[model samples]
Target: MNFDNLKNIYQFAEHFQKEEYWQNLFQHQSSNPLPITNSPSIKNSNIFPVCDMYQKNNYFYIDMELPGMDSNKIQVNLLDNNIIEVKGYYRSLQENCAYYLKERQNLQFIKQIALPNRVEERNLQFSYKNGIYTIYFRQN
Candidate 1:
């Protein structure tokens, strides 16, 4: 075979190998029942709230740490397919007042996450207290 033909065959084989590897990885992840932890981190630097989610029986529980946020400012929306959107604005009380030092960030942020399983839209529950937001969902 010519040099150009040989190079094309090698590239085709490499592409095929990568495709097979990715197919196997996806199959392994799907067949296993274990939860997938540690997804890619968000690129936002505005100190968005942290959240922990777990499934128990037919319900999913999500607890978020929202320090320095008021309950009235938080907004929750139940989108299609177990996706929830949490949005809120954080404004410093001393925005107008002169401050010597300021560490906290004053801005608006939104976080949206998809749950492992689908949930009943009407059965969703939410509670905010002590700088924490607890969201509960029941499976349909």
Candidate 2:
């Protein structure tokens, strides 16, 4: 509660507030990092949505958490047979509202996921439930 304690607390908060701090902390812990293509429309490579890719029951699935995101605003494109690009924006529930602790901000995000094998035969589908978007591919 003293001046030095308050100063130290402020310094700690300032350090965590830096974008680099969070980026380095969560720096792509996945064993296989997907290759992201640079495009003029997308910005901020740091805005990566947590994703998991796996195969089960003859289906290749990519489940990505996009909390509070509008389904209408999301776009999933098959860049190729083995690569997919997901583009979307997170919108706040209220406009011009002041937030004391806002972890999720209104920002654009583009995430590309590379599959282990090419999903030919054109059987692709997706579903969103409980803020998690699951993309399904029929394994041939």
Candidate 3:
């Protein structure tokens, strides 16, 4: 191919790589953008909360975003001394009536992570701040 053709191909690829093209291509066409919390009953669609885990310096951390959730609704448990389980329910509706049962399905999320090593369970601490759960552990 001539240099002109090569230049044109490069330009096409460069344009395709732009953020706007990809964003428009992947944009959901639905008028109502459904979040994971909106449709827990969707078949084959996993709505589990996303998490980030890592070890830094003297602490191992597992963080998950849980916006609009009450801290009291969340439960954390350490299983088998090595596996940690985080469970919670998030509700968007507040009316307490059986009539809404069919219309409202609370968003429940659970995430479990296995520790790389035994941790000081007695000293392990966690905090929920700024719409995130942060579990901290120091290696035993």
Candidate 4:
């Protein structure tokens, strides 16, 4: 029919094709972790710790930046699925003081990570040292 109508049809088909391509690319596997939703603790805070994940010697390692955080304040858990969740609270030392410029504040944070492979819950371990929180998992 009209050239403009043909162009519109082409664009509509391209949009659906693009969406289908991504859906195929991101199709979830049995080992894939589910989506992460914002918890109440994270909804009001903008703090998300930087992290790195790697594998070595049949083990998966996750290292997260949590400067000035104590081991007691951090908790780690392996979900029933293949996700590892890290949760912690940070209390600002200057909470009682008012400053013209303040960047850090008391906050609760949650970070979820999908393991490269399935890991046994009993083999999960973690340690916090020198502002780095490390999680270890033996590949199953």
Best by TM-score: 2
- By TM-score, how accurate is candidate 1? 0.58
Residue-wise C-alpha lDDT for candidate 2, range 57-85, written one tens digit per residue: 98999898887787777898877667788
Candidate 1: stretches off by over 4 Å = 1-47, 56-58
TM-score of each: 0.58, 0.63, 0.56, 0.61
Lowest-sum lDDT 10-residue window in model 1 = 38-47
The CA lDDT of each predicted structure is: 0.70, 0.71, 0.68, 0.72
- RMSD for all candidates, in order, please: 18.0, 14.7, 12.8, 16.6
TM-score of 4: 0.61
Clashing pairs in 3: none
User: Which residue runs does candidate 4 get wrong by more than 4 Å?
Assistant: 1-47
Residue 43 in candidate 2 has what lDDT? 36
Which tens-of-lDDT digit does each residue in 12-74 have in candidate 3? 566667786676667788863532222123221232466788888978888887777888788
- What lDDT tens digits, residue by residue, belong to model 1 across residues 67-87? 767877788887887688889
The true-versus-predicted C-alpha distance at residue 30 of model 1, in Å, is 57
* Model 1, position 34: C-alpha lDDT score: 42
Off by over 4 Å in 2: 1-43
lDDT ranking from best candidate downward: 4, 2, 1, 3
Better of 3 and 4 by lDDT: 4
